[model samples]
Target: MTAIKTEVAGRTAAPPPRAPRRRAQGLQGSRKRAGWVMLAPALVHAAVFLLLPMVMLVALSFTDYQFLGAYHWVGIDNFVQLMSDDRWRTALLNTVLYTVVTVPIAMAVALLIALGLNSGIRARGAMRVLYYMPQVTATVAVATVWLWIYQPDVGLANSVLGLFGLPPQGWLTNPNLSLPSLMLVGVWQGLGAKMVVYLAALQSVSRDQLEAAQLDGANRWQTFWNVTWPALGPAHFFVFVTSTIASFQVFDLVFVMTKGGPGSSSTVMTYEIYENAFQGLQLGYAAAQSVVLVVLIGVFTLIGLRLQKVSSDV
Candidate 1:
């Protein structure tokens, strides 16, 4: 009877060990399947929208392809040809000039506006809304108003100049002034958004720290440099990078106002791409240019990120 009891106990314990092991394995498999099920929609969407389009673009860049027309593989010929394209060179230079000119000036102005709003001034909220009005305003409406304001004759801009006894000037029509003129519009349009961003950042600054700086005999400018500016690092980086990207991709304003003229004076990368793909019908070459533009944006973005990282570490 004792031996029989021992054999029964052994059998029960052996099955208990194997049973839990089998159940755990099954549970792990089910969890893995559920995870994949959860990710399936996102994966499918990325494949359809981003991955597939990128693949097609890269492929098209290697061939002499047009919209709904016969295409032939041309290898690197298109890319080689694009290297010497004068129009592309001019567009690249103009884009760089626009970015350099607009981004710093806009950021500086936005910071000042944000700082002014943040001060213990009456009607601060109203001022903020007023400053941010341009962001929500329709681009077309803004462009149309700006077009009239830039008119060589009886425009608002000229009228303002006349008040100061300054002569009326050709704003957009002059090649030398065309890019800068468009840049002013760009700065005005983007100022509101950047100001809002900086305002949000300024709110996060420590009032106690600011007060401490004042107690230590620091003036307004010194307090800002030591206490406020460092706190706004993230916002500053974001505005700088985004402003740079927007300047590079400037197309709509050029299309509506300049049409990349006064003879390509204000042409940018995006405008060039549009002209090539739609107007010139050189889809392959345009795709190559698109690839170049993507690279340029990526390079700038990476540089910005690296600088941000370095600043944060410091």
Candidate 2:
């Protein structure tokens, strides 16, 4: 029996090793070639479109270049000048203020709308469409409609205020109110997509856990705080990051509605960049500001991620 076992073991171990090993190596090589082939287009696209443009922008930022003029290297002069530019400083401050104001209010409103819609209300589908319409609408069209609505003399907003015996507001014309007015437009346009996201997140929550909470006599608020909120952690993080970034990059509404008007009170970073690059013909300065914008966005996103981690750990 020992001899039989030894023979069986030897038979199992004695297969020709070189051919199978070579076959595996060949298969691995083929897979690598296939992967490279599949990835080549994307890599080429990044190099040509993204990487090349970034390199060009960085190079341009160091030069005293305009859109149509002789270019010469200035060695951080553009960045140095940016430090003292009052217009740029105001633009930066306005951008930060806009982001701080818009993201929280928009997210809160969206979350509430999602909760209401998710509660199995009648005509929920139509309501969803209605909420989502603003998001899908063209920005230009929305801005045009909002411009009409904000007309202090004959607009719907003033009419509504009149109905309640309240005074009309100088929404876009007032320097102090222009930024907030743009922020409201942004919130309105952004609410629908975020509400849809929250609705989707709410749907994925485990019904069994909710049922168990109810069996344990948990109230709606308690169940939400303990079960629903935790489950929506990922959604919250996503909405926060994207909403913050969008707020920081806000330009369309300002450009369309205000044109950075009312004594430059509504000017934001993106609009500032556009003004420097095209309107003011300071491409190098715009490039430097653009780099700063990129850095700010990256740093803020990292901080948000850290906060999310800390909250999750707690």
RMSD of each: 4.3, 2.3
Instruction: Output the number of the lDDT-best candidate.
Output: 2
lDDT of 1: 0.91
lDDT of 2 at 288: 93
Regions of candidate 1 where Cα sits further than 4 Å from its true position? 1-43
Error of 2 at 21 (Å): 5.7
Question: Which residue pairs collide, candidate 1?
Answer: none
How would you encode candidate 2's per-residue C-alpha lDDT over 19-53 as one tens digit per residue? 88899999999999999999999999999999999
What TM-score would each prediction reach against the true structure?
A: 0.86, 0.93
Q: Write the per-residue lDDT of candidate 1 for residues 1-314, one digit (tens) a residue.
A: 99999999998877445888899999999999999999999999999999998888889999999888999999999889887989999999999889889999999999999989988999998998888898899888888999999998889999999999999888888899899999999999999999999999999999899999999999999999888988999998999899888888888889898998889898998999998999989899899998888888888889889988888887
TM-score for candidate 2, please give it.
Answer: 0.93
**lDDT at 198 for candidate 2?**
99
Task: Give the least accurate 10-residue stretch of model 1, judged by summed lDDT.
Answer: 11-20
